[model samples]
Structure formats: structure tokens, C-alpha cells
Target: MKHLFTPYTLKSLELKNRVVMPPMCQYAVSSKDGIVNDWHYNHYVSRAIGGAGLIIIEMTDVEPNGRTTDFDLGLWSDDQIAPLKRIIDACHQYGAKVGIQIAHAGRKAEDADIPVAPSAIPYDENSKMPHALTTEETKEMVEKFRLAAERAIKAGVDTIELHAAHGYLIHQFQSAFTNKRTDEYGRDLALFGKQVIRAVKGVMPAQMPLIVRISAREYVDGGYGIDESIAFSKEYKDAGVDLIHVSSGGEGPILAHGKPGTHAAYQVPLARDIKQALKVPVIAVGRLDEPVLANSVIGNEEADLVAVGRGMLRNPYWALEAATALGKETEIPGVYGAGFSLKK
Candidate 1:
């Protein structure tokens, strides 16, 4: 049976194992320039050294104001390319293929003077109101996404993931609760996301697979559920998305009526449903920190890959430790060989 340590491939991207380090924002950009520094380098390369098969960089915005915070990364300028390439190259040396999540915070762009969204709505009562983008401006936003993908390719990424989840720009456009527009974007909820998938795919190599991360179940009343997500995801798949990264609950505060389970592997079923419904591969995430539990997801063919976010944050060597626990043979650096060796 396939397990977490098994090698996997899709298009041109090949992985040494099924373990993925999903993007977790550090908010660590010094100087507010969106250029990665020492903190970013060490944070990602350590995970590569620790044996992760894939390391997806955090949500990088398309424009300065598109950022969730001033400290978040951006690909709006050509100058930002080299710094990112440095990180990607270092990670590759350690055997981890890299990808980046291109996103725009939209209504959730806390640090923008005034955020932008599909509708003139505040994220919540306390949140600042966002300017509704006109039709032309919305089209321009798609171009920004295309440019970001072009830069990522120049930075030497093996793949690219569009951050359409977590209440960001794409999610705002897709959710009826947030998008109250009468324009074409609202007429078809998946239109903006589909445009983005096609735009990014245009710049990417045909052999490079594109991943789209979507919140499979929004845990608020009036928000979308798995069925709605499956419908929209089908549109994305048809638009050139190769894989779906299943996650949940970033639209708004969770309501009593739609509360999600807190147990481990709670999101596995969601991933399974999407994979079976769409006939596409998926990366399952959410509280899957246990090695055995993560392996079981792969063994059962529930998800093609497993992402351990919080667990990887706490232990840079989480993959190495998992290999030890699962009795799987994984390469450990000779410098760190003593740590993994068993004393007779």
C-alpha cells in the first residue's frame, strides 16, 4: 500500500515522498519590502534538510496592497525574483521541491489603506470596508495573478499553487456571503477563480502542474459546503488546475449550525469526496500531525499527499521523526546520522 514516505509525481514535479510542508505565513518580512531574508531562508531550508518532499512558500501577494500585512511577501516587481530564487535553490539542494502560493488578501488585507474586493463589504463588523472592484479593475487583478506566476517560474519553482482559499481575494469572489455584486463575477461564483487558473496556466510550462487550494467547507451559515465546492472545483479543474488542496473554514466566524469537528483527520473525508467526485488528486490537510494517521490517509487512498502544517512548524525535522516512527528508510544527512541511529 502507498504510504506517506512513498515517492510521487505529477507532470514535471517529482517528490521523494508524499510528505508536504504546506504554506504557513511567518509574517517575518523585515523592511516591509516583501523580499525574503535570513528568517525565511532558515525556516524553509531547515524543513528541506529535515526531509520534507515539498515545501510551499507562504501566501505571496500580487501587489503591495494585496498583502494581508505589510510584512507579507509580494511578487509585484522584478526585483523580488532573485531573493526568492535564492531560497528555492537552497531548498532544492536539500532535496525538497518548492512551490509558492500566489494570492491577494482583498477584504482581508489588514494593512492596506483601503482593501479591494468583489463587493463593497467589510470582512466583519470591526473590519474596514473594502472598495468594490469595477469590471475592468477585476480583469486587471487577473493580470496581476498572471504576472506573479511568471515571476515564480523565473524563481525556479517546480509548481505553483493559487491561494483561492482562506477568505482571500478568490474566496471573497466565490462566496455569496461576501460577494454581493451583480456583475459577471457574481453571476458565476467560480468565474474569477477559473480566470485566475487559466491566467496562471498561460505563463507556466505545460509540464508544470498547477495546484489550487480551496476551502472545501465554509463553517458559517450562508457559506458554501462540500457540494458547492465540488461544483466550483469542477470548473477550476476544467480551467487547467491539476490538483486540489483541500482545506476548510476561513470565510467568517464559525456558526453553531455549521461548526466543524475538531478531531484529527476531520478534513480527510472532504479531500476524499473531492478526489472521487472530480477524478483528480488532492492534498489533505488540517490537524493531521500524527505520522501513523498521516500514513493511513495515503495507505487508504484517501488523499494522494499529506500536509502537516502545525506539526512541521513545531519540529523542523518532523519528516525525519516520522520516518523513524513508521520504520521507513529515509535519507538522513550524515552530519545528523548519530541522532537517528538506534543504540543496540
Candidate 2:
């Protein structure tokens, strides 16, 4: 039976274990230049050291204004490559494959002078109204994703994740609540995501996988849900997406169907649904901090991988501890092993 410690292989990608540290924004970039610094290096490298099989870097914007904040990582410039390369190289040294979540914040870009989205919709009443992208500019945005993928390949990422979740640029385009355009984009909600995926894949190595994160169940009244998400997941898989990182909400929370419960493995069902619907691998995330619960998802064959978010943030050594708890054989650094019971 598969467990969290089982080595997972997708195409040419071989993970030492199934523990994935999903992209959690560090907001540690020292300048608006979007160049990674010591904090990012230390942050990601620590997780790799802690024994995460895949350390997916945070929502790295494809363009400056696409950022949720000025502090988020960016791949728009060649200068940003080396700093990110530094992190990827360090993670590789620790036997962890590193992937980057290339994204655009769109209407949710809190720090932009004026955020842009599929339409001129404000994320919420408190948020600033965003400028709508012209059809030509929308094409330009797709090119930006392609360029970002090229830079990520240059930085030597083992894989690349397109951030389409949490009310970000791509999600804004996918969710009907945020996108109210009269163009081809709004008519076909999956069009933008497909274009971006195709664009990113064009520059990526054939063996490398592309993961797309999606909010499978948006809480708002008119937002997309599991069925719609499944339909789009199929479209994405057809467009070269190798995996789907299942997440929920972020489209201006309405919670009319009731908010998602704050329980362990809350989003595993979403992942499972997509996997079953598309026969595609999925990374189950959201409050899967417990070792047993995380392992259960894999053991039950519900998901291909498990992503630990806040749990990892609070304890960089979560994976190491999980290994010890589950009695899974792992190379815990000698220095850290002393902290675990030596009786075993």
C-alpha cells in the first residue's frame, strides 16, 4: 500500500517521497524588484532539509503588476533567475525536487497602482476596481506566461505549477463571479487557462510536468463548484496539465453553501474527485498537517501527493517528524535524529 513516504514517479520526475510543501507566499522579498533574497533561500531550503519530496516555491508572478504584493517572487526579468536558481540548487542538494508556481494576481493584486483582470471587476467592495484587459492585452498576458516558463526552465525547476487558484489571475478568468466580459474569454471560461498552459508547456522540457492549482469549490453564490471544476480539469489535462493541485474558496467568499469545514484533509475530496474524473494525479492540500491523515490520503489512493501548508510553516521539520511518527525509513540528519526517540 502506498503511504506518504512512498517514492512517487510521474513521467521522468522521481520524488523521494510524497510529501509536498505547497506554494505558500513568504512575502520575504526585500525589494519591489521581486528578486529573491536570503529569507527565501533559507525558507525553501529549510523545508527541503526537513525532507519534503517536492518544494513548490510560492506564487511567483509572471509580471510585476501581476503580483499580489510587491514582495512576491517574479520571473519577469532575467536578473530574478539566479536568486531562484540558488534556492532550486540548494533544494536539489537535499534530494528534493523543486517546482515554481508561476502566477498572476490580476484583480487581486493588492499593491498594484491598478490591478487588471478578465473584466473590470473589483475583488470585493474593499478592493480597488481593476482595469479590464483588452483582447490584445489578454494575448500579451499569455505570452508573458510563456516567457515566465522559459525563465523558470532556465532557473532549472524540475516542474512548473500554474497558479489558477485563490482568486488570482487565472482563477478570475475561470470563475464567472469575477469574469464578466463579452469576449471569447468570458464565453469560454477555460480558454485563458488553456492558453496559459499551452504557452507555459511550449518552453518547458517535455519530461517536466505542469501542475495547475484550482479552487474546485468556490464559496460564493455564483462561483464554480466541483462539477464545473471537473469539466475544466479535463480541459486543462487536455492542454498539457499533468497534475491538479486541489484547493478551494478565494473568489470573494460568500459561503452560501456553507463554508468548508476546518478539519483535517478537508480538500482531499476535491482532489479525489478530480483524480477520479480525469484519471490525473492530484496534490491534496488544506489542513493536512497530521502525519496519519496525510498518509491516509495516499494509502487510500485518494491522491498522488499530499501538500502540507500551515503545518509546514509552523514546523519546517514536519516531514521529518512525520517520518518518525509513521516509522518510515528516512535519512533524518544525525543532528535532528537525536531529538526523536532513539529507542526504535
Candidate 3:
């Protein structure tokens, strides 16, 4: 099998290949309700049929207020389940495993009525200050993750990923720069991360795979960085996370820089470092647009999985095109089935 086509087993599921469609925001869903429309299903199903091993749907907010943007998707309520189910079912039919990235955008929620965080901190000077969550509210957030996981399971996704990275709510709690409260959730820098892990543990079944997406580096003074993130992963492995989706911080264009450079696999080390220390699966992502670059990471064992975001966004047939570059045939999702009339 090709390196990218090699099977990867995470917890209970075996991905048919190593190519992963990372969680990317399409901003398709409107804020009016929780349901993901046809746009989402078509968007992901295209990649699924294009032969990506795993397609991690973009962050599905655990609550309406937890959404990062008005168009963000949600798994907070039952109504949203059917749309996700359609996406998952479509992916599975094409022999691709589907995963849902569930999150609480927290302070990142724009124009939120009840902006929440471990402490009251402004997301940015121009951004509105969030309301520091009460103890009861914090516990509810944990359960919200639980309910979200439950909904994900009901939607038939193969795995559930907790979004604890980015400068969102969970990241806010993990970073000492953002979380500065005296309370239990605030007393420790790692406290907020633990809450997310606990929430994942509570809601997911032992048989279901659990992954955590974290910003390995904050790229800001006093913000969480690679070392701190490795420690966070070690603790997560101890707490039973199946994979670490190592992403960089969600800093705006102001601080956009990687550990090495903005070349392919620039952020591979975060996943590599965490895997070496934790002895678990690490997913490397970021501008990995070339087949050779992706093969290099997996062949040399720099990381276990490669998540392609914009590359796949620009060309849903990227995986197939990549496979062809490595001397293999291609398969495009059937929704575009007619478009591939020549191939068939």
C-alpha cells in the first residue's frame, strides 16, 4: 500500500488510509438554528469520496452561545443530529471514516449574549470581554461536551474530537495569559485542559475513539507554547485521549508564524514531540499540500496522520490527484458522480 494509503487504527476504528481532512470552517450554516444544511453534507462528502481516510468536520459548537461565528455548526441539540448523520452516513458509504470536532468557542463567540471563559478576559483589545463562568456554569459546560459527544455518536461519526486549541474558550483556560482567576478552574494553568479531557471521558464510550485538537504554541508572550502543549498531551494520554491533533494557535494575522517556517509540514514537530513523549498517535497538519511532503512525514515517522485543510479545500479531488502522483487511480465522491463520467 502507498504510505498515504496505509491503514491507521485509532482506539476502535481503523482508518482505510492516512489522509485526513482536517476540521475547516466553511461558514455555511446560518445562526438561525443548529441544523447543518446540504452545503455541509456536499462539502464533506466530496472529500470523503475523493478518498480521504478521515474527514473531521469543522468545530460543531456544543451550545448556540458557544459558537465562534453566526454560521458555525452545532451539535448542542437533537435537531442538528440528522444533518450530521447524513454527512457521516455519506462518508461511511464511500468507505471513509468521519469524525466531528466539537467545541465551545468561549470568548471567541462573536456578539454573544453570554460570553464565557474560565476568567473574564478580552479575546482581544477590540474584542468584547467575556463573562467569567460560574462554578455551576463550568460544570454545565462539561456536560455540554458530554451531550455533544452523545449527539455525535447518534449521528454515526466514527470518532469525536475535542477542540481545546485555538485561542477559544478551552485555550483561554489553558493559557496563563488568558486565565487569571483565583478559583479552582483558574488556580492551575492546566485546569481548563483537564476539564475538556474529563468532558471527553464522560461522554464518549470506551469503544469510541477520542481525539483532542490543541494549539501546540500560542506564539504570544506568556501564552501556551509547544512545551506546555506537550505536557498537556501527556496529561491527556493519561486521561485516555486516542489522538492529538496538533494545530497552532488561532492567533489572527498579527502573529502568524510557525516553529520552523510556513513551508509544508511546518507544524509537524508539535505532533512529533508530543508523540515521542506521550507514546500515542499524533496528527500533523498545516500547509501540507504536496504528496511527497505528506509521504515524508509518515514514512520517516515524523507523525502518524496528516491533516490537509486548504489544500483539500481548493481541490476536493486532491487526495485522488495525490494518489495518482504516487501511481494510483482516483475516485471522486458520487455527488459529483456525473462530473467524473469519463473516469467511470
Candidate 4:
């Protein structure tokens, strides 16, 4: 059986351990150029040096307006390739694979003059009203995703994650609570996500795994729960999604007034359920900061991978610390060797 410190393989990528650093937006881009700066390179490389098995870059938008804010990262242009390549190459040297989460914020785009969604629905009463995308524009957006994946490959990433959760563009199309479209996309809720998966797959190497993050449960009155998410996950799997990163809420302000709990490993049940239901490899996220809890999830076969978000942010060397706490033998890069040596 695998444990937190055990190596795990998915397709051509073999992770040093089951620890994943899920995508968390940095909003560090200045001048709205959507390009990486010194902050991004230092941020990701530190985690690699600190010992994360897989370091997923933040939510990188495929288009300018697709960004949650003008400061988010972007892969929409060729000029944006080299900077990200630097981060990927550095991580590879330290035995940590890197991936990028390509996403479109949809109606939740706080930077756009007017955001776009499956429908014209506003995220909340205080939020800006968004324009409903026309079918043609929707098709164009799929092409955008494909192009972005192509760019990511050029940047030399090992995997690509499609962000369809947190009420983002793809999520907007997937949930009935937010999508009130009268078009075919509305009728086939999973179509947008499926098309994105296919498009991304087309640009990706056959050996490269594609991960899709989804909100397994919505917190609002009309939001989707695990059951509905399971059905959609099956459809996405059939459409070529290799892994699912299970998360919940962000469909609206529902969490503030809805039923989802916010304790340690709160979303593990959702990840476990998706794994059992679809028999697909999954990455469990959400408050899995404590080493014991993260290890137990793997020890119990509850999830194939565990992502430590807040904990990781607080300490770049979280994985190294976790290894020490669990008494698991792991490599600490030559430069940092003396610092983590047991003999010391």
C-alpha cells in the first residue's frame, strides 16, 4: 500500500511522493501583461527546493478577460512562454514535476469591464452583471484553451490542469445553479468541460496526464452536490480526463450561507467518493495541512494524492518537514543536505 511519502505514477509522470501543491492564484502580475515576474519564479522554485512532489502553478488564464484579475498569470501569448519555462526547468532539477492550471474566470472575472458566463447571471447581487456568451464565442473559447495548452507544452510542463471549479468559466457551464442557458450547452451541462478536455488533450502529448478540478458539492440551495458531480466526473473521464482534483463551493457566495463545513480535510470525503464512484486517480485538497492527516488519507487509500495549500504557503519546506515528522526517508537536495540530515 502507498503512503504519503511513497512515489506515485500517473501516465508518464512519476512523482517523488504523493504531495501536491495545488494551484493558488498569486495575482502578482503587474502592468496587466499576464507575464511571470521574479515573484513567480522564486515562489515556485522554493517549493521544489522544499520538496513538493508536484508543484502546480496558479490559475493561468487563457485570455486577458478570462483572468480573475488583471494581475493573474496568462499563457495566451508566445512571449509568456520563456519565464514559465524557467520555473518548470528549475523544479525538474530538484525532482519535482510542475503543472499549470489553465482556467477562464467567466462571470467571476473581477477585472473585466463586464465578465462573460454561460448566461448573463451575476455572481451575486453586488457583483457586476456579465454578458452571456454566444454559441460562436463559446466555440472560440474552446480554441483558446487548446492554444493555451500548446503554449504550456512549449513551456515544458509535465501536466496540465483544467480549472472547472470555484464558479469559473467552465464551472459556470457545468452547474445548473448558475447556468440558465437556453442553448445546447445549457441542455448538456458537461459539454463545455468535455470539449475543453478534448481540446486540451489534442495539444498535449498522449503520455501527459490532464487533470480537471471540479466542485464536487455546492453550498447554495440550488447548487450541485456529490451525486451530480459524480455523474459529470464520469462524463469527463470518458472525455479524456485522467485525474480529478476534488474541491467544493465557489459557485456563489453560498459557502457564507450554505451547508459545507470548513474543518481539516473537510473535502476528503468528496475526493474519496469520486474515486470510489469513478475508479479514477484523484488528488484530495482542502485543509490537508497537518502531516498526520495528509498521511492518513494516503494510508487509508482515501486519496491517491494530498494537496497542502495554506500549510504550504506558510512554509515552503512543508514536504521536508512532513518527511521528518513521519520518519520517512526522503532526499533533501545536496545544497540543503546538511540542513535536513538526521545525523545533525
Candidate 5:
């Protein structure tokens, strides 16, 4: 009977419902320093108002140079804390749990043409070929990630997610296709990911949970695969990560297999495989827009949690509405309740 509306808990934080707001970039907010603005607050507030159970804030960069766009959110400075506090408080008021994803874009940082990466490679044709991070500079990134996690804690966020995948910084170290150096930090992909986790935990409260978003499969030849991903997930679990949000086929803009044209649950298999490998829970996210699809996945134990992306953007109150359509006991907002119909 477990469906999309089931209550899930990780660590000490309890989610009111199962729907999660996956981190999707909103590039219109800021350019240089990544200051949180009305556009940022209102965008997330609207989603919370739509009735998501847990609201994971967008990829908020841990360093200024970590930005992927001129207008991405940044938590590198203390000044950024208050603006985030507002968003966190708003989500809390709506009975939704809030978690901030602190990230470092590495070679993907968009502001400057000269960015840092494990090796000198471009994420894409438009991407800049980055310089390798020196030993001291690499250590600096560790501190930046740690301080960002600490700031998120101070902002009263329920959880902190390290952006380790999706062609970002930790991803640079995690993927061998882009990271070709012979140093301990380069070829040993697991070590760099471990350091990021260790450093983040060092600054976080003992009670707070840490989540890692990983692209379970590169879906490319000679790239990282599920075996490597699960092995790393085991490390994440042992390193004390509370959950591994299973997603796949990234580290590049377009996959060789063609993602935008793939089947609905193309990525769910990654979650299923990783779930079997590790003791920690897994969250599956792909084209899970239908209630039956989501329910069937969770009900059949394909994944412990389902993340609705484009579907959520298309319908903010999707969880409540889906539960309603499925005949589950869930409330409907007065404004949209009177005439709403699953059939229509």
C-alpha cells in the first residue's frame, strides 16, 4: 500500500510527505555575487505552497567561483545567510522540511573563464578548460564546502546535500574521463569524494543529516558506472551520509544514449541497483509524472523514495493531487479543490 504519499524519515528529520523538490537551476536570479533575491524566495515559496513534503533548496554554491551561472545562489559569504534564512523559514511555515544543497561547480563555474578542476578539461564545448587545483587551493575548497555546510546549519536548514555529481566539482574528482591526473587526489576518485564528505561532517551538527546526489551511471564508455557508484555510496553510508538520492547519466550535458528521448523510468534502474548495494535509502528521480508509476515503484520496492522533477514543475500540488486521485486521504487546497478533477 505504500505509495507516493508515504511518510519517510532520514536521520532526525521527518518529512511531512514523500514529494521532494529536486534541485533545478534558475538562472535569472543573480549574476556576479549570487545574492538571494525575491525571485529566488518566491520561486521556492510557490513550490512549498504547492504541497511538496520536503523542499531541497537549489544548488547553492559554496564558493563564489563555484557558480555555474552568473545568476546562481551563493552561500560563500555570511551576508548570504540571512536571505537563505527567509527561504528556510517560509518552507517551515508551510510544514515542509528544508534542506540546502551546497555545491562547488569546479570546472563548471560560469563566472570566470579560468576555473579549477581535477584536470584541464571542459564540461562542454562552451565550457572553459580549467586549471588544476594546487594542493593549497584544493585544501581551500574543502574549507569552503565545510563553511557552507556550517552556514546552512546556522540558517536552520534541516539537511545539507553535497553536490557531488552532475558535472560539478566533486563530480570532477569522481569521474575519470575528466580527471586524468596521477596524484592521490585525482585518480583515486573515492578519496576526494570522501574528503568532501568528511570535511562537511566536521562542520555540521551531530543531529543534522547529510545527503549526496550522485549520477549513478555516466552512461558512457570508460566512465563511472553503477558498481563504482554503489561502492562510493557504501563509502558515503559509512562516512555517515543519511541518504543517497539516486540519479544517473550525467557529467556531461547530453548523454551518448540520448536522455531527453529515453523511456520514463530509464534512470530508476540505477536507483534500484544502488538500493540493493547499500544499507542506506535511495531516492529515484526521472520522468515519474504519473501517480501509478510512482506508487508502483515505491510499492514494488524499486526505490525507497521517488523524486518528481518536470512533473512537479508542471503541477506544484502534485503530491496532494496524486494522492487524491489515488483515493488516498489527503487534503486539497481550497482555491483549487472545488472543481479539480483527476479526469479533467
Candidate 6:
């Protein structure tokens, strides 16, 4: 049976194992220039050294104001490319294939003096109201995403993940709760996301797979659930998405009726549904920190890959430790081999 330690591949992206370090923002950019600084470098490269098969860089915005905060990473300028390339090169040397999540925070861009979104909706009562994009401006956003993908490719990424989940820009456009537009975007909820997929795909090498991260189930009232997500995911798949990274619940406050489950593997079922419905590979994430539980998801064919976010934050060598705990042999750095050997 396939397990967590098994090798996996998608198009040009090859992984030594199914262990993925999902994009978790560090908010560590000290200069506010959106460049990858020492903290960002050390944060990702360590996970690579610790044996993460795929280390996805955090939610990197396409424009300066598109970021959730001033400190978030951005690919808006050529200056940012080299720093990111440096990190990717280091991660590659340590045997971890790198991918970066290109995104815009939309109404969720907290630090923007005035944020932009599909509509003028504020995320909540305390959130700032955003300027709805004009049709022309909306089209420009697509170009921004395309440019970001180009920069990521230039920086040596094996794959690129569009951040369509977590109540970010793409998620805002796709979710009715957040997107209240009446133009072409409103007429077709999936249009923005589809355009983005096509735009980003255009810049990527044909052999390089494109991953779209989607919140398969929104946990707020009137927010989309599995059925709605599957439909849009199909549109995305048809538009050139190669993989779906299934996550859930970033729209708004979780209502009592729509509260997301806090249990381990709670989101696996959603990932499975998307995988089955779309007939595509998916990376399952959400509280799947335990080695045995993560292994079970792959062993049962519930998902294609497993992402350990919080667990990885707690231990950079989470993959190596998991290998030891599960009795699976993986290539450990010679210096770290002694630690794993103790398990035998």
C-alpha cells in the first residue's frame, strides 16, 4: 500500500516522499520590501535539510498592496527574484523540490491603506471596506498573477501553487460570501480563478504542473460547501490545473451550524471527494500532524500527498522523525543519520 514515505511525482515535479511542508506565512520580512530575508531563508531551508519532500514557500503576493501585511513576501519586482532563487537553490541542494504559492490577499490585505477585492465587502465588522475592482483593473490582476508565475519559474521552482484558498484574493472572488460583484466576475464565480489558472499556466513550462489550492468547504453560513467547490474545481481542472491542494474554512467567522471539525484528518474527506470527482491528484492538509494518521490517508488512498503545517512548525525534522516512528527508511543527511539510527 502507498504510505506517507512513498515517492510521488506530478509532471516535472518529483518528490522523494509524500511529505509536504505547506505554505505557512512567517510574516518575517523585516524591511517591508517583500524580499526573502535571512529568516525566510533559514525557515524554509531547514525544513529541506530536515527531509521535507516538498517545501512550498508561503503565500507570496503578486503586488505590494496585494499582501496581507507589509511584511509578507511579494514577487512584484525583479529585485525579489534573486532572494527567492537563493532560497530555492538551498532547498534543492538539500533534496527538497520547491514550489511557491502566488496570491493576492484581496480584502484581507490588512496593511493596505485601502485594500481591493472582487466587491466592496469588508471581511468583517472591524475589517476595512475594500474598493471593488473595475473590469479593466480586474483583468490587470490576472496579468499580475501571470508575472508572478514567471518570476517563480525564473527563481527555479519545480511547481507553482496559486493561492485560491484561505479567504485570500482568489478565494474572495470564488466565494459568494466575500464576492458581491455584479459584473462578469459575479456572473461567473469561477471565472476569475479560471482566468488566473490560464494566465499562470501560460507562463509555466508545459511539463511543470500547476497546483490550485482551494477551500473545498467554507465553514461560514451561506458560504460554499463541498458541492459548490467540486463544481468550481471542475472549471479549474478544465482550465489547466494539474493538482488540487484541498483545504477548507477561511471565508469568515465560523458559524455554529458550519463550524469546521477540529479533529485530525477532518479535511481528508473533502480532499477525497475532490480527487474522486475531478479525477485528479490532491494534496490533503489540515491538522494531519500525526505520522500514523497521515500515513493512513495515503495508505487508504484518501489523498495523493500529505501536508504537515503546524507539526512541521514544531519540528523542522518532522518528516525524518515520522520516518523513524513509522519504521520507514528515508535518506537522512549523514550528520542526522545517527539520530534516526537510534530508532533501530
Which runs of model 5 end up more than 4 angstroms from their true locations?
A: 253-261, 333-344
Candidate 6 lDDT over 121-199, as tens digits, reads 8888999999999999999999999999999999999999999998999999998988888899999999999999999
Off by over 4 Å in 2: 342-344
lDDT of 3 by residue, 80-179 (tens): 8887888899889888898988898888898577688877776788777789888778878887888888899988988888888887777777778778
Q: Rank the candidates by lDDT, best first.
A: 1, 6, 4, 2, 3, 5
lDDT of each structure? Answer: 0.94, 0.91, 0.81, 0.93, 0.80, 0.93
Q: Best candidate, lDDT-wise?
A: 1
User: Which pairs clash in the backbone of model 1?
Assistant: none
**lDDT, residue 302, candidate 3:** 81
Tens-digit per-residue lDDT, 50-93, candidate 2: 99999999999988999999888899999999988998999999
Predicted candidate 4 versus true structure: per-residue lDDT over 1-344, tens digit per residue: 67999999999889999999999999898779899999998999999999999999999999999999999999999999998999899989999999999999999899899899999889999889999999999999999999999999999999999998988999999999988888889899999999999999998999999999999998888888899999999999999999999998898875445356557888999999999999999999998899989999999999999999999999999999999888788899867857774422
Please provide TM-scores, in order, for all candidate models, with all chains considered together. 0.98, 0.97, 0.92, 0.97, 0.94, 0.98
Candidate 4 residue 280 C-alpha distance from true site, Å: 0.3
Q: Write down the lDDT that model 5 would get.
A: 0.80
Q: Candidate 6 regions off by >4 Å? A: 342-344
lDDT of 1 by residue, 82-127 (tens): 9999999999999999999999999999999999999998888888
Q: How many backbone clashes does candidate 2 have?
A: 0
TM-score head-to-head 2 vs 3, winner = 2
Cα shift from native, residue 298, model 2 (Å): 0.4
